[model samples]
Target: MAVTDKSVLYQHGTLSLLVPGLFEGTMTIGELLQHGNSGIGTVQDFNGEMVILDGHAYQVVETGEVHELTAEQSVPFATVHFDDPKVTTHETKLTKADVEQKLLTDYPYKNVFYAVKIRGIFSHMLTRVVQKQEKPYPNLTESTKTQPKFKQENVEGTLIGYYAPELFQGVAVAGYHVHFLSNDHSIGGHVLDYTLAEGDVSIQPFASLQQHFPLEDPAFLKEDFNYAGMSTSINKAEK
Candidate 1:
């Protein structure tokens, strides 16, 4: 049988999951979701493929295949800055498969680039069963949200600067990918790095990232820019 025809199964209580013909490991929901700030194992597709990174989400229509965490989907991402001046570099726990690496910088320096593996499940029946019985996903409304320190979007921020390589032509910097998590309501843009460049990169705050290199339109860090529910803009509801 095609993968789509099979059910997308979620864990009994947590967001972790299992899929058709892909169940061999003995990872618990807690063990699977113990990840970086991106909520790696928390992401599951209808097909049972757990997300191993923080990226876009997608779904294959021909066979009703839903993509968990992926590049094709535009999921919310973040590039958080540490408060302490000395704490420039930071890391968020992602999926288990993610391998952390430190790239060399221009002046011959090294910095850590967080490697995240997003989560996604493929069994429709799993998540359905989990949802029907437990319904334990925390009330997101009570959660604290991270946002850009500055209000307006600027073109000088590192996030935007990333798009314009010339902006950071010769600087000691380390860059990596991040996720923009959203709240119950849609607001604030979460900035993440896709690492178009490879070297000792600089990480910036939400405001600074936006100022350094701003996107035309930005989503709040809390919103899920990837693997989102069907969009309402085009009336393309999931059948």
Candidate 2:
């Protein structure tokens, strides 16, 4: 029952700093690809969203457009892995919460990382996209407060994200953090909530993780990250 027996999750940067408004990136999309084929993350300056699926990289900007990313593009934070998941198909409908519960009920393993990919038609998909921030960017909670939200129906897409254990809480979000990409590649964003009509849920559990940080970046080096009430901030930001 060891998940990710064959793959390692290659992560760049730290989620804690990004949450607190460190939009500067230490790694390029090209460099990130050297590690894994699939994952999710944000672009430099918090300009837009990022999705890596099937060894390809994509960017979803504030303009509601999806662009194929170039190697030179910078990434502030991302999680990627060579995905060969253990999957299960479901014909029944399920809410976001229900999906989480089902994952726990079946897998039931703690203290590991899981790459969650759900593909199907969604009855309702509620998503949010953060705008690019200027210098002195606001923290994640404040930045997301004014984000634009989209509501779509009968949308076919894949939900991409990761589930981390409590031990990595401050370093990574402890629970599910997923993003969405439509099959047509026209509609996608950070998933706030959704209901799946029917689809397949592919779960890849990674027993090991590798973190890469940008030690040379001045911003990453100088920022005095304040974690006070970070739990509350993360909870508010996730929704």
Candidate 3:
């Protein structure tokens, strides 16, 4: 999908495919960045949590190591858009829930997509990075069971991710699906919780979401994705 409009959110692949173990990546990091500069995703085979900021991709692995991804690195699933904030708010001493509530209250278009970026010092931060999967891969929920989690205090970083409506649960995470990357590139992962010390919250709302499927991957092409528990699995694995 070609997204000339900067307001549109560009997504590659779906959580529905990831839930059932379709880990093969059809889009390269280089290609994924053409559509947006800031977003979140995972590397091929769920190797780590992917955080894109300032037009560069970083992988936060299970060992709490952060690597700047090359253009050739493969991305199984991601959501990104041009980091042009329509509204920017300065906030201090807010919890994760507080931030979410503020965004929702400020932008109450329940069915649209919202890209969020928060950069500042965090008094408390908790995150988890999924381990890379091998062949005969376990489902997303099962794989995340052994994922390594990390916590830090007074860490400085940026939170990059999106807020999708509940109606789009399978296509994307229903609520806030954010990943963190520290200023020094030392700590980062899928954010589980945090308390913002002080920061700038930027929001860009999009009326359209362009989803590109992995039509070339045999697993993505042939898998029966009509399982009854897909939503349950996504909630279990992501939240």
The per-candidate count of clashes, in order, stands at 84, 0, 0
Residue pairs with clashing backbones, model 3: none
Output the better candidate (2/3) by lDDT.
Answer: 3
Best-matching candidate per TM-score: 3
lDDT of each: 0.21, 0.83, 0.90
Judge candidate 1 at residue 113 and give its lDDT.
23
The numbered model that scores best in lDDT is 3
Worst 10 residues of 1 by lDDT: 124-133
Q: In model 3, what lDDT does residue 45 have?
A: 86
Error of 3 at 118 (Å): 0.3
True-structure lDDT of candidate 3 = 0.90
Worst ten in a row by lDDT for model 3: 1-10
Q: In model 2, what is the error at residue 187, expressed in angstroms?
A: 1.5
User: Per-residue error at 221 for model 2, in Å?
Assistant: 1.9
| Candidate 2 local distance difference test against the native | 0.83
lDDT of 2 by residue, 22-96 (tens): 887678888888788788989988877888988788888887788988889888888888878877667568999
Ranking by lDDT: 3, 2, 1
TM-score preference between candidates 2 and 3, better one? 3
lDDT of 1 by residue, 67-114 (tens): 343332221111212211112333333221121233223222122222
